[model samples]
Target: MLPDGMTRRDLGWAITGILGVFFAAMISMNVVVTALPVIVSELHGTQIQYSWVVTATLLANASSTPVWGKLADMMSKKTLFQVANVIFFLSSLTAGFAPNMETLIGARFVQGIGLGGLTALAMAILASIVSPRERGRYAGYFGACLATATALGPLVGGITVDTLGWRWCFFVGVPLSLMALVLVGFTLRVPVLEVRGRIDYLGALVLVLTSGALLIWLSFAGTPEFFDWISWESAVLLALAMVLLVFFVMIERRVSNPIIQLRMLVSRTTLLAALSSASIAVCLFGMPAFLGQYFQIGRGLSPTESGMMILPLVLGNLIGTMTTGRLITRYGRWKPYIVVGSLILTCGMFGLATVDSGTPFWFVLTVLVVVGLGFGAQMQNLMLAVQNTVQVTRVGQASALIAFFRVFGGASGTAILGSVMAMQVVGVSVAEVNGTAPSATYADASGTMFLVAACLTLPAVVLNLLIKEVPLRTTI
Candidate 1:
């Protein structure tokens, strides 16, 4: 049986609120991209710190996703969703007034907490209302929302930064967040899975510690001066993280109401979907960090121009996501779209690897569109796969797990790729490039990063192949 009053429903205005929640979160993330370099320069933040601005938010998002999902399972999804939005709303306002890198990063961390809830709860609600077979069409709308937000984010950031300075980018999303809250607050209705037990506080502690330690390592490893990958600091942190992970596992095994269910995790469908998400994440997170820099620095474009230049990526993403989502729903199969997405992603990455500052703008745009297309197609399916494999009661945690892996992978990719860019920039400075060395350095670095990123997709494809497609359930 389903929760009372929320069964056999098709999306209505509630879809507006759901998409609004996602759009608000995406706007906040995207709006900051073009403003990042300016924010760093204005704040006198180090390159490491500049990279941390994005990575910090992602880490926080990853860490909090499961907690938020678990809370939705134990409590009211609608209330939890609103709470997350309020956190984002307040934090965005605070972020606009931030005087330094520390304050901005802190605000982003809080914003990420809200974003995590939106991400997890949005999917849970989708799964709760829409059947797996019909979910793809609706999921396509979700993907379109993401693509639209991403497409417009750079434009919004650029226009705001150019007109009102960088701070307004942070502030602009506030009204949208408020709108989402009001819409969802009044319209959203869903049944909560009633479970009796205390929240696994100890599991949360160990999980955070474990995730924190690993993220710290990812944030700093192999960068210019932070910590060497083979250094004692690395060893100590990794060791501690591993031990805590072990402890977290043990704690979950014994907990009466575990936040994460190991049995659910071990299932082939869920496991493979998670693995696929990690690679897709590398693409998703790596793009904003690298391509954002490329347009601004490498291509010698203004923020507005860069934003416009990146629109094709969003277009590609929209096509891929919506096309796959629609096709999957209509045909009642998912594997074909996923495989095609993987191929397209790898092809795009390889094409991007060949690009330099002098490469034709059209070529670059086409390649990015390819990447976006692949990501659009692959991303939601990963979540759908997990949702399909689990029961309704498992929806919240299962959805959270998929999001957690994607964000965690994104955090790792962003940090690692950011470090690579910084290291190459340092290398360029040491060798003395002739003209506009910083931009040249960024160009040289990004080409290689794209090639490396292509390698990341192969494993995800392998995992996707292992995902056995169970027939999608027709009812919620």
Candidate 2:
């Protein structure tokens, strides 16, 4: 080991490598949201399938996150980190060369598995090295990377799809991932434990089945031929999901080394923070997937112009995230920001609900900026709160659990919103063709989808009110 205490140079290299990996993974996910429409049209996919491209990744990531976290507790984190990178590298290449939508979706699933490992392991490693008090300062820096990636991913992806091709979006992650691999190899080292236990394969299986069934049900709900609640198929799927979830919970209680620890979920701090994290994701991840389409299809703007339109939202997110980080460090409290962020989000979403084809561009931008700010302020605050409450030994479980719920919420939200948009499009299209009035199918879908998105943010505000602010400790 270099020394008992960390040097500034050592910390700098660790933070750089960690943030670089985070930036690359986040960019890879968000970049595709703006490019989805173009990819779907080019590949001749239906709206449901297009939505699955996003949902599949989120589901895969959410499902695998806790497993990675548990593995971090038992294995060498550095070695595991390299394993994730290699998977990401290979998946990117396969995604770039995919001949059809099916193959692309499969590749994206593998990529999500890699992403889940990277995010969970990174946060666990950071927590291991940093104290709770100093973590806020570093959390700010990490938040900045997340905000930058979220903001830039769309603008860059949109431009690339329009100018280069959609395939470049996948290929682009390779070099960034490679750079991260090299940095980690040279700069970071953590002590490895050789402890071993049986992996909770049964619990993992049940959790996957539960999440997958619920997501599939949501995606098909409101589609043309999908089952209604009263229908036999829908009832069976819903019952199966309930059964699997209950079984998973029972398994967790009995297992010595559960994939997800039951004790973590029982903590009030973890429960509230987790629910809040999931709520924020529903709005943050769901809204952007369709907003780019709004600018292009509804307003008739070029892809580049559409990307440019959302820049205010990105800027607002950066400002809000940085501001919250500083305030938390100074006050050592988190509840007020969560409350304020939620209220702001509610106001912004309500404002956005009124958007239509005739709405001014400036008005839309202003509404979205408010939503972005609220999301930025609240999102990572929840994570910080949960991490601080848990012991160092359990930090990996706590961090990964928060991430799991957020991505699970994201996957479900995207599928639900996409289905809603599809139904509206089909309904409007058939009506227009049969009646005297004529309108483009794309325009109707874009306008209606945003209105629905705005409605979804309201529930998040209610959930935010339920989060209790626990005082932060000055020491670990």
Candidate 3:
């Protein structure tokens, strides 16, 4: 037996359990992405509603992530992880049975809460046992699971929709999550911190309110064809969002255990890490949500064909993550990977910005590879940077903070970019009604959408360059 009476065989089981939890959470997300167009059309939802169905989960994930992260410190990580799975399965069941756009969106919000628990607690639970340096060694397995989910989710969703129905995309995730719940209960055993502090309900409330309001306002702004951006509706929401944010900061400063410890933000490294994480979030989660539209609507590909096209991106992500994780673990250094990843992000997205309907399949695949490479190199390493700077017990808070920002970035980028995309598409759709070709219109607008994301990558490059490379801890 090892020092804690845990054997090597036990580590293998624990990792399996964690991986299952991740796959259940992540795959359920991507599965719905490609199927969304069909769902919206079937439900007679608008462009804005379509974006909400996806981003609503993300917003809820962002809001509840810290709450779950904090819970890890006060309870059994294993129990919380299993509880999250139950919540996820139930939410998926609710979503699968949703008869309208409103019900589906509501179901997704609940699912996001469950996803927050899985995503945040999984990382925290692993950190509770594994050191940051060694995380790289095992991170490849994590990356592969993530990449596989990303790569296959759309493919499965497309096939399911074509053969069975769109509801199956939501339905299938339930069994997988239930399986993960059972597996984690049987396999995962870890010590909990059991920190003595009251939960920060006010800070949590304001954090969610501010974040939800901001994204909600952006969602409104995205569909300006329905309403003006300068209208009272947008102005009033934006005003409340700002006011809530100010109050959030104040509440955080006074709270015994803030959802996010305000003191952590003072670190230059943490700030850089936050910015870098935000940028990578745009690249990883925000950018990919639109490919189905481009392939099916813009280029007239079949669902299965569009699913096939997603493989290159998934493979690209897998290769990047595997390469970066091994190197970081070996060298115990992460700066070069971050720099290279940022550069790849800028290059890949900028290249994709010029794409049109007739853009070569090979060229698009190549650019997606670069994006995957960049995403792989940056995403996990940024988390490592943040965790290294904090006390071990407080790693949950740090991980949640970085994760919270990623949720913020992913939701905000999708909202803003989705708006830009919808406005342009609707403009051209109106023109199409007046004789413009739908394919040509969508292709041109898609290029502009990518260009906006590409331009956003530049700031991240600057932030990554500025991150102070503090020495990583060699032990937990």
Worst 10 residues of 2 by lDDT: 429-438
Q: For model 3, where is the 10-residue window of minimal lDDT?
A: 429-438
Native-referenced Cα lDDT, model 1: 0.82
Clashes of 2: 0
lDDT tens readout by residue for model 2, 359-386: 7888989988998888888888888889
Write candidate 3's Cα lDDT for 1-476 as tens digits.
Answer: 22264567777777787788688788888887678777877887777887788899999999999898787777778888888888998999999999999999999999999989888887887787788888876777787888899888888888987899899898877767766766667666687678888999988999899999999887777475655688888888999998999999998888777788778899998888887787768766666568776776777776667777888888888998888888888888988888888998789989999889789989998888888888888887888888888886788878887888888788888887888888887744322321123276666788999998888778778999899898778888
Name the lDDT value of residue 358 in candidate 1. 78
Q: What is the overall TM-score of model 3 with all chains considered together? A: 0.95
CA RMSD per model (angstroms): 2.5, 3.2, 2.4
Error of 3 at 60 (Å): 0.2
* Tens-digit lDDT track of model 1 for 159-246: 8888899999888778878888887776667776777789998898777778778878876788877878899999999999999999
The better-scoring model by TM-score among 2 and 3 is 3
Candidate 2 regions off by >4 Å? 1-6, 193-195, 427-444
lDDT of 3: 0.81
By lDDT rank, best first, the candidates go 1, 3, 2
- What is the lDDT, from 0 to 100, of the residue 200 in candidate 2? 86
| lDDT assessment of candidate 2 | 0.79
The estimated TM-scores of all candidates read 0.95, 0.94, 0.95
